[model samples]
Structure formats: C-alpha cells, structure tokens
Target: MTSPNAAQVPTIKSALKFFKVTSYITGIFLILIMVLWAIRLIWSADVWIGGPDGLIALAQFSVDPSTGEKVGLPGPQIPNDFTTVSLIIHGWLYVAYLFGDFRLWTLLRWSFLRFLVIALGGVIPFLSFFTERYYSKVAEADLKKVA
Candidate 1:
C-alpha cells in the first residue's frame, strides 16, 4: 500500500542495473569481434601480412579442370579476407543490443538521437566501452539527484 507520490520518485538503482547489464553484453560482443580479427590476422598470414608475396603464391595454384591435374593459376583470395569470427558475432550481438537499447531508452525517457548514438557504439573500435562508461556515469548521477 504505497502512496501515488512514492511511485513518482525515479529509481536510480534500477536504471543503473539495466545499463550495467546491457553494457556488459555489448562489450563482450565487441571483444569477440576483436579476437576473431586477431586470429585471422595471425593464422591466415597468406591473406593479410603475407602481402603481395603471399597473394601471388596463392593465385597460381589450382586443380587442372579437365585432367584433375593440379594447375597453378592465381585463384581468388579468401572472401573472408575482410572478415573474421569477430565480425559475425559482433553483427548478431549488435541486433540484440538494439532491442536492449530500445528498452532502456523507453524506460529512461531518453531522446531518439541519443539512442541512435548508443546503437552506433558497436561499429567503431573501443567506442562502445567509452560510451557505456559515459552513459553509466550520467545515469548514476541522475539517480543520485533524484534520491
């Protein structure tokens, strides 16, 4: 049996809690992308660090079309050249983040423009961490003021 006015008070704890959870999830996704990129760069030297030498070597070797003989011709480079496991994980996680972002924005009555920036946090490297920290601080401060 609480009074109507009691409900009017903003609950900072709840807001902070939501922010923290979403931040953690998003950060994990970003880290995964980075890890994938590193693995691809290190293990698949023929594509990245090997540069022109690796490229040339990779291109000239193929199987003979008619005789099943191993033919040496420059073949197309791996399509995953620009991608890694990180990109795939990050992409899916980003869509999930959108749902969380919308939920939080609705809860906090945050502006659409601010929400857009938050959503864009995934594309840029290390940006999500900074954005999460900044938003967490802002939400915490707001909660304190309400208290």
Candidate 2:
C-alpha cells in the first residue's frame, strides 16, 4: 500500500508554486512603489497656477510691466495621483502577499517567527527576491525528502 505521506506530495508542490508566484508579484509592487516615491519627492516643489490669461502656467517669476521686476504668486500644485495609486496598489498586493506567506508557512509547519520573516519580504525592497529564492530551494528540498 502507498504511504499516507505520498498523497501529500502534490499538495506541497502546489503550495510551493503559489508561494513563489506571490513573492515575485509582491516584490515587483514594492519596487514600483519605491520608484514612484522617488519621483514624487524630486518634483514635489514644482507648482502650476492659473495664469492671468486664463491658462495654466508654471509658478515662476514674471517681469512686472511697470516695476520691471520679477514677481509671481505661488499657485496650487497638482496632486500626485500616480504616487497615490502606487501606494494603494502596493498596499493591496502586500495583503495578498501576506495571505500567500501564511499559506506556505502553515503548509510547511514553520514557526511563527519564520512566518513574520517571510511577511517582511513584502515590505523591504529587494529582500523579497532573496527570500523567495532561499525559501523556494528550502521548500523544494524539504518536500523532496517528504516524498
């Protein structure tokens, strides 16, 4: 008769696949958020205002007709929609990553501390790539031994 453990091989394989995919996705989102954050920080001071001519004009000093001196008023800056969207997307993806982490952690019967470490992979930029690689190898080896 086949051993009971043999029946679990497929399940473990599927879980491994799921965890790997989620790790890559979460890592990608983390990178995207970092890029967006950088862009927002660099260009945050540039402002656009409604010009006297009824057109949008970048906030800059204009020569006064009489005084022959540069003078300009600060205008309302446009919102950074891209940064906002990036934050929202990353937040949701992290949640999904957590779910994936929980699944693989439970399946592997790892300790709670290990689970927390895997979850951190989603938050720390570039860490997910290494974590995923390490965990993938470890899980595969463990599963092979079980099989």
lDDT on C-alpha atoms for all candidate structures = 0.57, 0.70
> All candidates: CA RMSD in angstroms?
9.2, 9.0
lDDT of 2 by residue, 6-85 (tens): 66778777877878888898899889888756644564322333435344433444557898743553532233234445
Going through the candidates in order, what is the number of backbone clashes in each? 8, 0
**TM-score of every candidate:** 0.55, 0.70
Clash pairs for candidate 1: 33-86, 59-73, 59-74, 59-75, 60-72, 60-73, 60-74, 64-69
- Pick the lDDT winner: 2
Candidate with maximal TM-score = 2
Residue 5 alpha-carbon offset, candidate 2, angstroms: 3.9
Model 2: which residue pairs collide? none
Superposed model 2: Cα runs more than 4 Å off = 1-4, 45-80
